[model samples]
Target: MLPSTDALLDGLLDWVRIETHTPDTAGLNSIMDLVQSQAEGFGATCQRFPGRDGKGDHLLVLSPWGDHAQKGVLLLSHLDTVHPRGTIEHDLPIRIEEDRCFGPGICDMKGGAFNGLAAMRAIAESGVTPPLPARILFTSDEEVGSPTSRSLIEDQGKHAKYALVTEPARNGGHVVTARKGVGRFTLKVEGRPSHAGARHWQGRSAVTELAHQIIALEAMTDYDREITVNVGEITGGTGTNVVPQFAQAEIDLRVPTAEAADEMVARITGLTPKTPDTKLTITGGMNRPPFEQSDASKALFDHASTLAAEIGFELVGEKTGGGSDGNFIADRIPTLDGLGPDGDDVHTLNEHIFVSSLKPRMLLLKRLMETLS
Candidate 1:
């Protein structure tokens, strides 16, 4: 059964109203407190892990009655929003008009967190046990790729039988079964400097050499294999009259599979510049590994889609170039993500969540959790 659509909407409204940007430590803590209080009221046991700054914390809520030694499913969410603390000054005070709910972080994730709590709350109120012993992990820093909470996510994920991440879906209403790998690399070059007007060949132009490497990298992109190498940022040169002594560039690559990732890494690391006059230094590696689909994950998706079909919506899946917390967990265990409300224009003022989808997705989550046992 699905959660009451009206109740889910009201809960999401309260959630987005809190300015819980992880960077804003105070705001993050306050939001965590609000959630902690709510979970406690549901009789869920909760614990907080504070960060280095003593500001933000990761909240873990467990089934009220469970054996500590046994591992079970872990549901993941984050208490932080991507917007700044003051974003509420403008697009805040969430408004629900027709089929959409507009606000900061409404669709990206906060809505998903609400669904997790609702499912557990429904069970708790009914005095019924969940499908299994469960763990709800609410992290603090997901927008920036879980810099601090990543190890903890993997640690808990390894113990659980399965993991569910609540990142929003690409299409308006669906879930993710796989995601491409993401990598960040820097290509730097050093050359001799001289007066361009007086001595042309006396200096090796680092900028010129960097241009060759950039072109070479771009040439490696193969659409057939779904590989993309993007030269996102470049900086070099001192003056028009002087040969540039140093040049640097940032590279972003997205690949579909581990084999593709390995192939790309080797090719990128061994890039030989056309101009040997400049010394090339490339430093960077895969930050997030690919969340390739596995047979187990596919079965889980089938189960979820079956549940969705039983409800009312046709279920489908898609592959995304974007990376999420799911990528990190997928490396060790079967994971499914992109399970939040539908929306677009995240990280901008125009961000909005489909008001109509919120309740349905919550219902989806509720039904799925019940089946997990």
Candidate 2:
């Protein structure tokens, strides 16, 4: 049997209290320690890889049942959150407000991770062996993009037949079947600098060149094609009295298809400086490939939807603009994302999960583990 809602909330709240910011290695390991202990207590063997490149450690826990050599379920969750260290103490405290439980990292995915473990624990206690073995990989860096853990996740994906990401569910319990590819780039403009008052004609303003380029970049957004290019950050100029010699803008790109990603990348990278004598440089490329819906993924969603209905709820699949690690393995294998608890206000001061969703979502995950072959 699944645990009571109150009991599950108690376990999940314990995790919310820990501030595991993406860069806080110690905080991340603290939560991972708890994860390892709980997973091992339920007969899962865990492998701990130390953090590198100023990131937190990652935990890989394999189910006690099934052969270690077999290709099985890959359960993914990131322990690191975007919230800072003192978010809980100052901003979003652990409190039950009506049906929502507000806390730092509660909905954005610590809740999902905890409930996943709870489902496994229930299975272990009931003496039921899953049809296929399960491996839960708790990663540390995902909020700032999985810089250090991406390779590790892909390596693990090679041995897995199915990938289920416990990212926060969307649009009221909708699992993600597709996501836009994400790309980041930096555009730098270099120009001749001179005193604005003394030699305005001789100097080329890097900031002015950057402004023109920004307009061109923003104009690339095509809602019809589901492509967006945003120049999110810009830095330029040294003083008001001097013409700027250098300017830089950070660009964000999203596309719904691989072809769109390639096309947009070429367009962005091939930009030529409009201002004569000013040098323009572009750096960076696609970080995640688009997660297009596939037949296998559709079948997986159908199965999950059936399970959700049996558990007394309807589950839907959505295509989101946000990218997840699901993008990494969706093309490689059958992948279903946003299996986490239903919630709203993710990555905000009011971030929380619906307390009522705890039991049903847990039941759904438990059933998937038992029934997915």
lDDT of each: 0.82, 0.92
lDDT of 2: 0.92
RMSD of each: 2.1, 0.8
Compared with the true structure, model 2 gives a TM-score of 0.99
lDDT at residue 74 of model 2 (Cα atoms)? 88
lDDT of 2 by residue, 22-124 (tens): 9999999999999999999988899999999999999998887888688988889898999999999999888888999999999989888888888888988
Q: Ten-residue segment with the worst summed lDDT in candidate 1?
A: 63-72
Q: Total clashing residue pairs per candidate?
A: 1, 0
Candidate 1: give the clashing pairs: 100-355
In candidate 2, stretches whose alpha carbon ends up further than 4 angstroms from where it belongs are none
| Minimal lDDT window, size 10, model 2 | 61-70
Q: What is the clash tally of candidate 1? A: 1
